[model samples]
Target: MKKRSFADLFFLLFVVYIVLPVVATMLYAFAGKWNKTILPEGWTLKWLATLFQDTAFIQAFGRSVLLSGGAVIIALLAIVPAIFVIVLYFPKYEKWIQAAVVMVYSFPGVILAVGLIRVYSQFGVPMIVVVLGAYVIGILPYIYQGTRNSLRNVDARQLLDAAQLLGASKMQAFRKVLLPTVYPGLFAGALLSFSVLFGEFVLINLVVGSRFETVQIYLMKKLSTSGHIASAVVFIYIVLMGILTFIIAKLTKQAKGATNV
Candidate 1:
């Protein structure tokens, strides 16, 4: 009983430490006057209203959605198949492939940006190519690791044997059986990649410059000029992430339960 109580207290403390700042900042978002005060003077929705009305913010938000969404789709389409191939067929080259994927994360963003600029400048790549490249390279590790982890639950030998026994072709077996089993992980990876790319700023800022303005860039600009509006944007981002996390948790849970049942 005493140990349980101590563990509960510790967990509560950890949660409080993590959540208090978020709570405070979210409250500040609704503050009519947050300056020169211990507490907000009053609460109002005007900050949120203004935040939603800003044309630059709106455009940046849309761009973030587009960039992150497209990046995740492209990442999944590319990575999932590659992982499946590595797992099912090219097991001999798994280490090399994984090392290559992981190396993408190891490259410093600034260095990568410089190299990309040099090559793209010579090749005359468009802004869209640069944006997509940033998104893919930045989030590659997250998707790769997540997909690898998700593949653990799937029994590869069993899948291959079942396919052979049923006279099903390798492609059909993979498409029908292996793909379904690992889809939860793929979905998780996609969501994670999307989340990472959503808040990503460094690569995009360096590569695309003013040609692109994502949510994070817009928020940074606001922060430098208007702290309150910046706080509001941060609050919105927190809320958005929370919603996405909740959805991912629910979906993952449902998937696991279905598989178990």
Candidate 2:
């Protein structure tokens, strides 16, 4: 009974620790005035309204979506098939793929950005394109893990062999059998990658700067001007992340259900 009481108290403290800041930020975003009080003096939506009316903010949000979506699409198109081939036919090479995924993390964002600028700037290549390419490769670990786990959970080899023995081509078997079975996990990975890239700042800031202002850069620029507006931006960002997390959870549950069947 004493241990149970301690556990409950610990859980309450943990919840407060995690939730207090978010609640405060949300209040500040909508609060007309909040100073030295437990609650705001009054509440208003003026900050959020102001944010929505700003063309620069809208553009930044759009750019973030485009960059993140583009990266995920490129990853899906390239990585999915490569992983399928590796897992299905060339299983011995999977170790090399794992090594490459681990190597992605060896270079910090600053170093990677500097290296990219040195290599790509000399050729006059647009930094946005370079960043896009880097984003695709950066997400390999998520895509690889999600896809590999999905395939492993489903006895992919037997499914593929059965499809092929039934007079289906290897490509056909992959498309009709393997893809449906694994799409939920693939989509969950894509969502996770999108969320990560959407909030990325350091590489994009160093690589392209204001030439391509993403949501994070925009938020950074707004920080000095108004606290309320910054809080509003953060609120919106948190909402987006929450939605993506919910969807990813649903897809993961579905993937597990499919695998179990």
lDDT by residue (217-237, candidate 1, tens digit) is 888788778767888999889
lDDT of all the models against the reference? Answer: 0.80, 0.95
RMSD list, candidates in order: 3.0, 1.4
Residue 152 lDDT in candidate 2: 84
lDDT of 1 at 53: 94
Mark the regions of model 1 whose C-alpha exceeds 4 Å error after superposition: 1-20, 258-261
Name the weakest run of 10 consecutive residues (lDDT summed) in model 2: 32-41
* Model 2: per-residue Cα lDDT over 1-261, one tens digit each: 999999999999999999999998888999987788889899899999999999999999999999999999999999888998998889999999999899998989999999999999999998999999999999999999989989988999999999999999988998999899999998999999999999999999999999999999999999999989999999999999999999999999999999896
Q: What is the lDDT of residue 28 in candidate 1?
A: 80
Once model 1 is optimally superposed onto the true structure by TM-score, how far is the C-alpha of residue 250 displaced, in angstroms? 2.7
